[model samples]
Target chain A: MELVRIQKQDFSVTEEIELVKAVSKSIGGVVVFLGTGRDISKSEEIVRLDFEHYPGMAEKKLQEIRVRALDNFNIIEMGIVHRIGKIEIGENIVLIVAAAQHRNDAFMACEWAIAELKRITPIWKKEITKKGEVWVEEHP
Target chain B: MVKIRFFAMLKNKVGQEEVKLDVPENISLEKFKQILKKEFPAITEFLDKKSIMISVNQEFATKNTMIKDGDEVALLPPFSGG
Candidate 1:
């Protein structure tokens, strides 16, 4: 089973990992990566972050990453979720769960999925600092 | 008419989420973008800097990609998601 979602509501990482783990009995290991809203960015105090996405295309790109990871890695299933709208500091921003028959496969796939998501997903974040708000456009 | 969508900083620059344009059928994506740049000068910097990307029907599109009436076209800036 594979799950890909873009939502404004926060999600439970444990629950998401459990759902992926339940997909196969032979799955021996699971790796999860959680991204939370940070209070500081580039030495500036960020009060909050506002995330925006390109609607249909954002979800489509995420699903594409999941399918590609499953095909390229030994993972049995992958779950990905990204939160949108206004997010306060320390709030959950994204989650990725990778389940595989071995720990190395899960670890590698989980890392690759997050990197790919950052690279291709049509999502953006604006840093609401004490001074002002600025949309983050630099990928490097 | 084809629908042109904008997201992230590009949306803010364009001052709208989406707009309808009476574009010629089978217009190359490059030409369509040229028209857009002429129409919305605010986004010209992004287009020139190559910071913007075009997607047709929710997929990445190239300059040679052909766009037709009723197709969904989007201008996407760099992705920052984790």
Candidate 2:
């Protein structure tokens, strides 16, 4: 939960922030990006979503992104956790938390990490709907 | 025997998560893709170079990338997860 975690269980935002704060020293700002599943996509009512990731590769890519952020920014604590399996509408699916001595580093590193994670990480999702299903092929 | 892994809709179309591809040694990723094209011709649109991405040994690969013995290759569709 400190660096990188990919799990099926839901995560506690409070616990995550506390851990980051507990571990880091003299951090001025903290930025966290919490991603949630939506009730609708493309105007279709999505009941829930089934998330699948390429086991080993997904973690590797996530760690790679994390490392790149560490190298580029002056961040102190960084944690990226993504949840798999079935996730309901409005449920949290992923969390990105970055702590830094400066507010800019915290915000920029947080944004950059998620952008890279969404771009390359091999985690996938299938939106299950009453009309059947849809494979979500793109992300924001 | 090289292992070809699939994910998401690609896995569903192939009816499984992975398949063993039998091929000569040192084939380019492009050629192996052609082999896959012949094997699962039903979903050729997913095979388009623009739509699909290849990872060799867990690193994103290009068409000229070579496949070696016992390499792990994955054909992925456009990723859609946060």
Candidate 3:
């Protein structure tokens, strides 16, 4: 069983790696994805980004995603962390880690988890650009 | 009784984050929206014309769907998260 978290604090890669190692003793592979704030959106320069979420609901949704991944994939461990509040350019936004007995499952599950998170999660990000602040509506 | 929640832009338009409605048993989401509009006229502008998604008990739902007491309903705006 893996833990899922949605918070406003920064995460350390070392801590995440250690968590992955501790959960899956039989793991043969680990896959991780880090989503970061980018400097540009649709050819405009971004200054800062603000993320807002429906607090309790957002956590519940992330837990549901974690459960769905476990039910759909043959993975030993999985964990996801999403950052909230204001963030600067190049800061970490989200992180996912999947560990499985095979390399293929680990990679595939990680991708699926992130894709589903983007599609279904209620958290929204607003980008403050040099031109103006715009609320992003879709991941496209 | 059912509790409905609104988030993001929808929340801003409705000027409320959540509301409790004493709906008749087995009321459809469409009728619920009507009641909401009547109760909160400010929401009419957002509900009548804007694109909003519904979730029943945290899962996606359509307007024709029926809801029960104690059910949790949510009106979501266009998702903009990574």
Q: Each predicted complex: what DockQ?
A: 0.84, 0.88, 0.63
Tens digit of lDDT per residue, candidate 2, span B1-82? 9998999998889898988877889998778878888988965778875968989998999867999889999988889878
State the lDDT of candidate 1 residue by residue for B1-82, as single tens digits: 9998988888888899999999878999788978998999999889887767889999999877999989999888888887
Query: Which one wins by DockQ: 2 or 3?
Result: 2
Q: Give the lowest summed-lDDT range of ten residues in model 2 chain A.
A: A16-25
Return the interface RMSD of the candidates, in order shown, one decimal each. 1.0, 0.7, 1.5
Please, what are the lDDT tens digits per residue for candidate 3 over residues A28-95?
Answer: 98899999999988888899999988667778878888888888999888888999999999999999
Ranking by TM-score: 1, 2, 3
Model 3, residue pairs in steric clash: none
Chain A only: TM-score of every candidate?
0.97, 0.95, 0.95
Supply fnat for every model shown: 0.88, 0.88, 0.69
Q: Please give the range of 10 consecutive residues that has the lowest summed lDDT in model 3 chain B.
A: B43-52
Ranking by lDDT: 1, 2, 3
> TM-scores, in order shown?
0.97, 0.96, 0.85
Candidate 2, residues A41-68: lDDT per residue as tens digits? Answer: 8889999999999999999998898888
Tell me, by TM-score, which candidate is best. 1
C-alpha displacement of A24 in model 3, angstroms?
Answer: 2.2
Q: What is the lDDT of residue A58 in candidate 1?
A: 92
Candidate 1: regions farther than 4 A off = none
| Docking quality band of candidate 2, CAPRI definitions | high
Weakest ten-residue segment in model 3 chain A by summed lDDT: A1-10
